[model samples]
Target: YLYNGAAYLESTFAAFKQRLVPVNVNYRYTDAELVYLLDNSDAEVLVVDTAFVANVARILAELPNVKLIIEVDELGEGPNPAGATIAGLVHYGAAIAAAAPAPHIERSLEDLWFLYTGGTTGMPKGVMWPHRSLIGSGGPTFKPFGFAVPQSIDEFAALALTVHDGAHDPIRLLPAAPLMHGTSAIASWGVLNSAGSVVLLTSRSFDAAELLSTVQRRAVTNLTIVGDAFAKPMIAELEAAEERGEPYDLSSLRLVVSSGVMWSQQTKEALLARADVACADLLGSSEGVGFANSVAKRNRLAPTARFRLGPDAQVFNDAGERVVPGSGERGVLAVGGPIPIGYYKDSAKSAETFRTFEGRVWSVPGDFATVEADGTITLLGRGSVCINTAGEKVFAEEVEETLKRHPDVHDANVVGVPDEKWGNAVVAVIGLEPGVGATEGTEAELRTHCRATLAGYKIPKRIIFVDSVLRGPNGKADYRWAAAVASDDR
Candidate 1:
């Protein structure tokens, strides 16, 4: 109920209602928005966030389809707004709670669910998610972690619900993040699927002290986050908690899970430093793929996690063939177990990426990986941006991860650009934390540091300090966005 996206929250509630799907009139939509949602959803009743009524009134013509426009309150805290010119609108909570529960209907496990994909990628396509298919193909692969802060009071109240039940009940998660992001959505679903609470967020802003206090007050046990952007701030927050004699009673914390981004070594170490929580890194991509590994797996894989012999890892040659034993060539990471149902409205993309392998279909995300003699999957990096720099092939992620460890840097993105001498020169786009600064000298220092950890050829030849790195809602780098933004600056 605390969600920022009216459409998404409506979708979730529709599922909860089982009979009636909630139709969210867009926030930007005037009453005209009401007509659009009503027409598309075939919805008879309209629920308006009363604060949004003024906007809704602009398109009064759109209200013809609305049988009832139930106005919602300040959300979980106060009564509904008073004095609306639209005389028919009533309070939302009372209306729903007062309504008799509809009798359950027999539903096929394969019953269709309309899912709205990110419009930013292309036109918004409503993908059909079948329950059985999701359980069979995607459930096992869901290694979800959430990173959220209360964006609004409603959202915070929602977050509080995620943790609070009764004083007798055990404290649970206070998942923070936009639910539109697949990771947080999955986590929220996981929480509720287990009969847990979900706290709402407001303002989308984060306050360490407030968050820590909430965790302590609720005795929270699990927190999920994207490893890179969130880890440092969290560590600092926790440190402040300990320093002020108001240490969060974090004994309830059991797992500090991450997945949205690769957990750099420092971030992992920092996580272990604070909480004795088990960290699980699920590696996957949107192209119907999944994989999971951690420092434990990497360390045991030893010299070549990418090439080490493991049942989980494999190498494929260019001939649509799997490599022989110990071939030592990097190939795309093909994931087994659960996978996505493929992209909606794009069959060609689905066919290109998903395939049957060794008799079972595998969702092979295009990450360049290798299996060492020990069979450990050593992830070289993503395959798409494999850069041949100075006659030597370089994986930008490897170099970026190495450079990001420097105290001065928050995160780094490496790309290869045309060069007269090297064919392609390594480019480093760095984003620094607040108050952190870098100069040409700093770049030089970073170069020297990289030489110690990376081959000279892999080290970036040119470094451009970036204000911020672009990330998708899933917290994955939008290489296309970065490339575009990179050009804008130049």
Candidate 2:
């Protein structure tokens, strides 16, 4: 697992980062830390993931001067949040290696390829990727001269549906989230594919104030956030200040995207409210399939649709049947056209996630989703988080949603706790709305609400109210963290 994120650092400091980074290197951080890293690098070009806009856009008020703000479109073609730009954007491949004048310029699959993984679950690592590995539907769009991508919604959205015609600008990026994860790195790769610039956020501080100041001073056009982790906090900061009548400017920004995790309906709307520009939410995985949504479009699919990943993907079941999606039946998600080369040094884990099916090989990222007849995929969350209580099986998210609507409840985590009566009983750890106090008896009130709202099995048998729930930098409710906290609380 050789790491090749050298281009991310400045030429003077590049040597320093390379020395410390060995075969397998991970770079994990929050938007706050990412902002500091980018500023310290003093990069002129910023290659941003569309997911971290909420975190970095306002901080643009801090950066004094910066030239380009490139946003990577991993799928290459899709409707973007920004009102279409005239002709400057490109995917990483084309933008970086185009040598119309510099005939001496050259690029190859041997060039550094960067990798990102989910870091909040563990330490962030950066895997060195070679260009040859970046190809097809699973890989970055490639070309003989260099990698290319679609330029506008017409080009990208069309190209994603059809075969690309080698016409995308390397969308450079300033990933507002930690650059150690696949979602952020792949977004950056989209820019690198075109040899476009990737602005690094190297500082240890990714302060929202710093980012807002950077955008305003730098005139940054693109910013992305990773799900609600980065998004909700940022908007909350702004909203909190706004409630106090403090004004902040977020006008220069053009595009903001949220991905890696699904943004709650409320957070998504809050972010869209801040934007005079476009906002998008994407869903995909490092080892599986990828799709994006917008505030207006709200990415969704009917249960009966069948999607063709072109020649790049296919469907199958546990028995290896081509698990065609219909009647609400879901199957393991797989990728073929451009599957990853398995995990680094862990072939067994790789084989588990990456598989061989049909005549072609496939990689199942362990997500259970149904593809509708219209081609849209309906994600049903992680299979590991599936809840089985009593004789019925329920997804934890379904129950969590019910708890969240309690009006007094701000958030909730539903996990199966041991029970002699019903086997694994449902236990919910809930965070209440701000200013509301939780008494020892608060659980009873919340339970009464659930009884009125949810099915009997779906209702939690135990409710533990906490002042606040702990989350990773990404804002995702760490079930493991919650599990330990709940056990300790009990």
Candidate 3:
């Protein structure tokens, strides 16, 4: 499905009901990228908004596997791309009305679920998830402390329907991230699996005010967002509202959750100050879940990138040995337990990611981290984007976070570009606060500020200020773009 959260939920659920696998398409993908993903996934039916029709039409000839097209009346302007002359073109509403009720199909634990990765390092690949593994280990199953998961589907359904007397009301959740992203999709599933209502933001773009308004209108109990990219703007909007003497009514919100990107400690504290809600930062990826998580509440805020490691998670060195806490050794984070089978149609990549460590299978998604003396895991960003400068490994995220800590910096993306002297030079591409100019003095000030918190080697070799740093719809940094910009400057 190629749309926002609202349509994504409806279409994904419908496909799930029929035991059919649904592939996620990043709506922001260009025609060629979309064609590559669609063809690679072997998609047979496409459900899309009218706005994307032209892009789809351009690639229609190449997508012979796509047998049917369902056009939703989202914009409600143009004629159906699949008109009478077009074979297998059907309106979404008409198709639903005309089709008979689907017969019950027994669902199996082996049923497939595909979530394509964001392709920051390479082309996006589908991660194959089994229904059973996804529910039990993909961070969705509502297993209370000391409670075992139900054995059967019927038991699980019964558990989902259970409502205790005087218990908190059914969770009304608002996922602010794009639904196409696994973080939002899995979160929405968790809500629906628990019989809760998911209130989706219908705006084409992220608007903090609109999201806050929806929360107020819907009496939403929970809100999900993608790290600093979403939280920073929302907090800014809240501060703006406060200045106007019209603060949003966030009393109904019980929790605010963030995943998929880095959520800074300052942002978390800012949010807690404005609303009396618990904030959770999840550290995981499409291939694994619950590697580590940090929770922030009023008067008790977790530091940025610091998380209490999950039960099934462990940090391992290059030799596959588990890294000991306080050793100060960097390693990859791996999770044991129910995890995805592999990347769909990519056995080589799958084998490299999913490996048997000490006789136990684990999913290591290439996130670099270190275990502190207290056993806390401090994330150092993904290894794929890690910069190698003079043989010293520098995590881009750590530097980016430092850059963002500056008062004038709005956002930052760091990348490693090829350098004759350093092998790969650490380059920082930053977006400053509104009305802030990209002056040499500002760059010098940022470098000096970074030096106070970061090691000399970890500091960016070159800082390029831009109006905006490239990011995906789900708030993930576009490292490719950053690298290109750095290369061009070099």
Candidate 4:
């Protein structure tokens, strides 16, 4: 589904009921990228917004498997892009109103769920998950107040009806993150399954004011974001509103959840100071959910990068032995329970990532971390994007986070480029804050700032400033773009 948040829910639910796997296409993808994803997924039906009709038209002939195109007339005028005419074209609203309701099919726990990775490291790959496993991965955490899991669909329906009865109220959720991202879609589905309502922002882009205003107007109870990319801007908007004596009524908001990126403690603390809402930073990926989770509340914020280990989550060293906490060994984080089967159509990659060790299978998606003395995990970022310099490993996210902590740095992406001296030199591609230009000594200043907390080798060997750092709609770092910039600089 190519539509925005909540806009595609009807079609998504329909596809799920009919056992048709919904393949997510990042709206920011180019025509070629879109075609590759659609063709690779073997998609038979595509439901897209009118705005994307032109892009789809360019690749329609290449995607023979896509037999039908359902266009959502979001603008009400029913815009049909030139050359987009197809034999099986249908408008979303009209088709829904005219077609008879589909009979309910028996859904098994083994039903398939596909979520394509953002492809920060390489080409996007779909992660294959079973419905039962996916539910087990995220369901327990999203359980409705005072309710337990239902044994059957009938029981679930009955429970859903009564979930909002008595003293409990239905959850009103707003997913500020794009629905194309699993983080937002899964959370939205959990809310809907609990007989709750989902509020969506109409703006095509991430407008902090629009999101905050929607939350206030809808009285949304839960808000989900994709870490600092969303939180930092939203917090700035809130602060600006307060300064102007027009603070939003955020009292109805109870929970703010973030996943898929590094959420800083500073941003969380700033948010908590403005409201009493609880902030949950979930450490997860397309492969699985619940590697770890950290919750922050007023006066109870956890340190940045520190997360309470999740159920069945452990750190494994190179030899596949579980890393002992407080042993000071850096290892890859793995989750054993309720993980994806493997990456679709990539057996070698799948075998390497999902493996059996000590009689248990685990999904290790290359997230480097360390176990503290108290058993909490400190995330070091994805090993797939780790930089190797002078035989020492420097996680890109660690450096990127440090760079972002700078007062003048708006955003940053760290990458490793070939270097004669260091083998792989750490390079920082930064986006400075508006009105904060890089002076002659700015790079030196950034390096000095990093030296305070990071080892000398971990600091960037070169700093490249840009107008903006390339990121996906879900706010994930675009390492490929950063690497290209770093290569050009080299």
Alpha-carbon TM-score of each model against the true structure: 0.71, 0.63, 0.95, 0.95
Q: Which candidate's lDDT is highest?
A: 4
Q: Encode model 2's per-residue lDDT on 240-312: one tens digit a residue.
A: 7689786467676656656655456666556557656556565556563343243432343111111234345
lDDT for model 4:
0.84
- Of candidate 1, the 10-residue stretch with the lowest lDDT total is 301-310
Candidate 4 lDDT at 63 equals: 88
Error of 4 at 119 (Å): 2.3
In terms of lDDT, which candidate is stronger, 3 or 4? 4
**Candidate 4, TM-score vs. the true structure?**
0.95
Query: Can you list the residue pairs that collide in candidate 3?
Result: none
RMSD of each: 8.1, 13.0, 2.1, 1.8
Q: Pairing residues by index, what is the TM-score of model 2?
A: 0.63
lDDT of each: 0.58, 0.54, 0.83, 0.84
**Comparing 1 and 2 by TM-score, which wins?**
1
Instruction: Select the stronger candidate by TM-score from 2 and 4.
Output: 4
> For model 4, where is the 10-residue window of minimal lDDT?
141-150
State how far residue 113 of model 1 sits from its true place (Å): 4.6
Query: Residues 1-490, candidate 4, lDDT per residue (tens digit)?
Result: 5657445887777777888787778888877778778888888988888877877777888988888888887657566764246666788877878999678678777777778886565667988878777666646534645655555677667766676564567789898888888888888777787778899888788999999999999999999998888998998999999999999899999999999787888899988987899899998888878889999999687887779988788899989898998998999989888888988889999998998877889998889888889989878888788889999989999998888888898899999999999999999999998799999999999999999999988999999999999888888888888999999987
Ranked candidates (TM-score, high to low): 4, 3, 1, 2
Q: Write the per-residue lDDT of candidate 3 for residues 405-443, one digit (tens) a residue.
A: 787988999988888999988899999988888765887
Candidate 4 residue-wise lDDT at 66 = 84
